[model samples]
Target: MARIISLEDVLKDQIKEINQLEMVTSFIQNKEELKDSLIQAQNDIEDLSIGVLGLKKDLEKMKEHNVSQRKLMALYQQLDDRIIHMTNNFPESLTQQLDRQEEKLNPIIKEKTPNSYKKPLAIVTNSDLTKCEPIITGDSIVKDCRKMLFKDPEDSYIIKELSDSEFSKIPKYMIGRQTLSTVNAFITTINQIMKFKYGILALGKVGARKKGELNLYLEFKKEESDLKAANQEGEIYFFNADDYERETNSKLDKTKLNLLTVLRHCKRIHEIRLGKNVKYRVITS
Candidate 1:
């Protein structure tokens, strides 16, 4: 268009070229922004891959820890089973050894312990009489029997010779106050002789007294009379130190002869004190 193109046409052509150049510059800028977007997306994908690998490594470690725990549980179960088996099947020799050990320790333990055996009882028998002399002599039997009766004057018994019908025929009061005494005295005499011969102190003083002698006849005269009536006929047979000396036929000191001491050794007699006088009694039964 060197052949003198119109001015309007030239201006139009220049405007079209400027529009194309502006479009080209815009496309170049858009291409550079797209390249930067692609680089950022690649970096994000690489970081995601690294995080997945770390998660896989942690899962493997957890699996290994679970296996170790299972192994430990199995070991504990095996140990418990072994302990149960050992307890249930213990050897007999071990049990015998334990019993022997206990027996060995028993004597040592007993050495420090107190005696617990039962005390032997004193049993008097006919065999014992055969070995010992009679405590009461035949001469002293009557005196000893009288002493026993005086001590418990109120106690009286019916004669075995008298039948129940015969005893009943007599008045009850008369039987108790009159006839009973003679029967009692007779029975007591026989019993005393047997006790002396057998060497048995069955009715004698069982234990010692604190006082040598004490007033025993505390009953009134009327009471004594009633007791005498209940046990004896007519007058009561009262004995003293003189009577005992006469009966025993031993001239030993009368004061030294404590009736209680004699009663302790004797099988048939007891003593009571009435005012200043000493009375003796026989033990029946």
Candidate 2:
């Protein structure tokens, strides 16, 4: 009976050892599979990294191929700038030459002219503006200091020809009821603006309506010979082609030139001496 019991205990011990060994073998196999999966994931990440690098290189090459287009765009910008420089003050070609002289007409003979302009620098109360009351627009109205050194009253009449007040019976923009003081002030203002701002550049002489002549005319045509004519009172400036285009809403063309000619002859057209070369610049706001 003792022998039988001992043998049974030995058999139970053997069975327990076998079960433990089986568990250990299963755990080891699972760990090996996990290691294999980790290795495969690392390989996939490296392959994906290589593909991304290749795509980046292709994009860089595409950008490099656009060099000519980039250069062309730069060239277009420069050409546009040159166009503005040339046409900024004289955007439109001239219908009448600058040297073309008209027969001296008194007060521009209300017959051939239209009424007052929409935004005139100066206005006259009647047909014979030289003898009648004139109204002008501006901040300052007196040419107390810089008298435009004009050569002839006829050329000065060319400046005075800008006003044609007989168009409308009523004054459109003038205020103060045409009183004595108001009329004088308006005349002063027009003369000042023309002499200082709107007048053209002249070497030896600047043309403006002289004092007490009872004529109308400051025009953008100033005496270039003496820019300090007025002893520095008004604002004088130059504008780039871009700004001129923006203000006028057109490129430099024949139509645009007519508008510019009117402005230059009446207001201020741009002509400057740049390094010994005479060039036109946009000198108005």
Candidate 3:
């Protein structure tokens, strides 16, 4: 076995060693490339995670903004409703104030007007009239007159004079004082007068040359319609008893047709007093 050494054999052994070294070097280079690829993949994953986090935060902000917008819209709606309510009610409030001021100045106005120019007026009260009929027919006559007046409109001047004449027939003391009994009696008398004096013309069934005299009747009819409409819509319609009496040439007692009794009987009616003036309304459901 420890035989003769050959130079060719030694050279072949040296060449095998060189091939093995080359294989080791190739394996090291491959290991380094694989490590670099792993590091790059880790960095990419981290970047993706950061991007996802940012998107989540943005989504949260957008949700908050949407909620804020909804709240703002609700506030705007409330403001709009308030404005509409004010607009609708302002004119009536102003008119009431003006009427009060006029009442305060009435004595001065009467004094200024000459006695000769002032016409002799017939002042009547609801209490002064007697009820001859059990049923009140004035309601139907009022409605009919309104329809007729609207059918053929007349001059404002003539209408004003007629209205003034009717109002003058009511006494100053009894203008605001009304009782249910008195009102009923007054209505009965009015119905009787309309039927006996005017006949078919009382309900405006026939045309007349004095159409302007029906202006007050038309106004009352309109008011009744307005009250009915308001009640249907679940709203309240109110008026001052004194102002109503003056306009309609009627009187009422303190107990019978008083605001409280009317409210109790009608169910829809409500009462409130501002100073001396009593305000009534048929409330909404």
lDDT of 1 by residue, 1-285 (tens): 468889999999999999999998887879888788889999999999999999999999999999999999999999999999998999999999999999898765433111222223434455544444335666562222332323322232111233444445664433444453444453454344333322211111221111211122222233346546555444333334543344455533532343223332333345556556555544443
TM-score of each: 0.24, 0.21, 0.24
Better of 1 and 3 by lDDT: 3
Worst 10 residues of 3 by lDDT: 153-162
* Candidate 1: residue 78 Cα off by (Å): 1.7
User: What ordering of candidates by lDDT runs from best to worst?
Assistant: 3, 1, 2
Candidates in order have lDDT scores of: 0.49, 0.44, 0.50
Clashing pairs in 1: 147-280, 147-281, 147-282, 148-281, 148-282, 149-281, 149-282, 150-281, 181-231
Supply the global lDDT for candidate 1: 0.49
RMSD of 3: 25.5
Candidate 3's residue-wise lDDT over 112-181, tens digit each? Answer: 3111222223233454233222344756521223222232211110111113344345454544565445
- How far in Å is the alpha carbon of 30 misplaced in model 3? 1.8
